[model samples]
Target: MTLSGGNARQALSRRIIDTCKAMNASGINQGKSGNVSARFGDAMLITPSGVAYDALKPMDIVLQELDGVCAPGQLLPSSEWRMHADIYRNRSEAQAIVHAHPTFCTALSCRRESIPAFHYMVAVAGGVDIRCSDYATFGTEDLSRTMITALDGRKACLLANHGMICFDGDLDRALALAIEVESLARQYHHARQGGTPVILDDEQMTDVLEKFKSYGRQPRD
Candidate 1:
C-alpha cells in the first residue's frame, strides 16, 4: 500500500532510522559514523548528525533540498549530507544511500585500494570493479566530487582513506549492498593474505551482470 502526504514522510523517516540501526547491528557500521538517507520529492531526508540511531525519532530526520538548503529548526543533517545530495542529483536511479565504515571496507580504503573483479560476485556492484575515490577531506565538496567520480557506472565505491558508500532503489537494498560490499572486501583481504587472487575476466563479469538482471526475481505468469 502507498502512503501519501505526512504519512509518507513519516514512514520514510522511520525506515531511515531502522536502516541506520540495522547497519550497526549487521556490523557494517559503528556508532554514529555512518549515515543514511532517502529521496523525498525535490528534497532528501537524512539522518541527523551525531545522534544515536536508537534515539532517532521520525521527527528527528532532517529534510534538505538538493541545492543544499535544509529546513529550519531541525537537527543538522549528517556531515556527509553533501555527498548524499550530490549522488541523488547526479544519479537518477539513487532512491536511497548508505555510507559506512565497515572494518574490511575501511581497511581497503585506507590503502586507497579499489575492489577488483577477483570474484564473479563483484558484478553485484554493477561493475567489474569498485573504484576508490581520490582522497578528500570528509564532508567537503571535494569529497562529494571525488565520490561521484568513483561511483561512475557503479552502485558502490570506497572513499579514499575513508570508507564505503552504496545506493539503490530503496533503503533496504541500499543497506544490503553496503553489507555485500563489505563482505567482498573481507573476502578479497583473505585472498590476498594467501596470495594474489585470480580475477574474473571482463567477459565473464559481463555475463554475470546479465544474469543478475533476473537474479532472485519471482517468475512471471
Candidate 2:
C-alpha cells in the first residue's frame, strides 16, 4: 500500500539520487560528507555512504525502515542513517531530510554558534534563530537525541562543531531549505567578522513567521 514497488518506488528512488547529486552541485555539500533521505511508507529512501554522487544510480539507494532495517541493496546506508530515522520517527511532519557541511554553516558550527535573527528569513526555519545542538559524536543515538531536541518546532538546526540539518514536506523543498540555510549561515559568518548582528525581536519574528504561512509557492485553487 506504500508505493512498495512497481514504477512509483523506482521514480522515488531516482528523485532521491538526483537530489543527492544536486546537493553536491549546489555547493552546500562537498564530497559525500552530507546525506539526503525521503520518507516513503513506513521507511525512508536514503543515499548510500561513501558513494560518489556522480557515480550513483537509482538502484544504489538504500531503503531503510523506521525500525532500523534496510532493504537489500548494493551498498550500505549513509553512516548518518540513524539520525534520519530518528527524525522521521520523532517528527511526523518531516517527509525529507537533508544534512550537509556547507562552508559557512560548518564554520559557525565549529564555533558552536547559532544563527540569530539578524535577517528576517531566519523565520523561515520556524524560529527566531537557528538553534545549534550541543556537540555530540556523530552517528550515535546521543547525537540523534540532541539533534531532535534542538530541532523541536524548527525545520533546521546546526550540529555543534559539525554541520546543519533540515527537513521539509518533500525532497525539493527540503533541498531548497538546505540551500537557503547555507546562505543564511554565510551572511551570518560575514556579519560576525564586524560585530554582533542586531537580531530581530520576537514580535517581529512572529509576524514574519505568520506571513510565511501563505508565502512562497502556492498550490492552485
Q: lDDT of candidate 1?
A: 0.95
After superposition, candidate 1 runs with Cα above 4 Å error:
none
Off by over 4 Å in 2: 1-4, 217-219
Candidate 1 residue pairs that clash: none
| Candidate 1: residue 4 Cα off by (Å) | 1.4
Q: Model 1, 1-221: lDDT tens per residue? A: 99999899999999999999999999999898999999999899999999999999999999899888986899989999999999999999999999999999999999999999998888888999999999999999999999999999999999998999999999999999999999999999999998999898889899999999999899889
lDDT of 2 by residue, 165-184 (tens): 99999999999999999999
TM-score of 2: 0.95
Candidate 1 versus the native: TM-score? Answer: 0.98
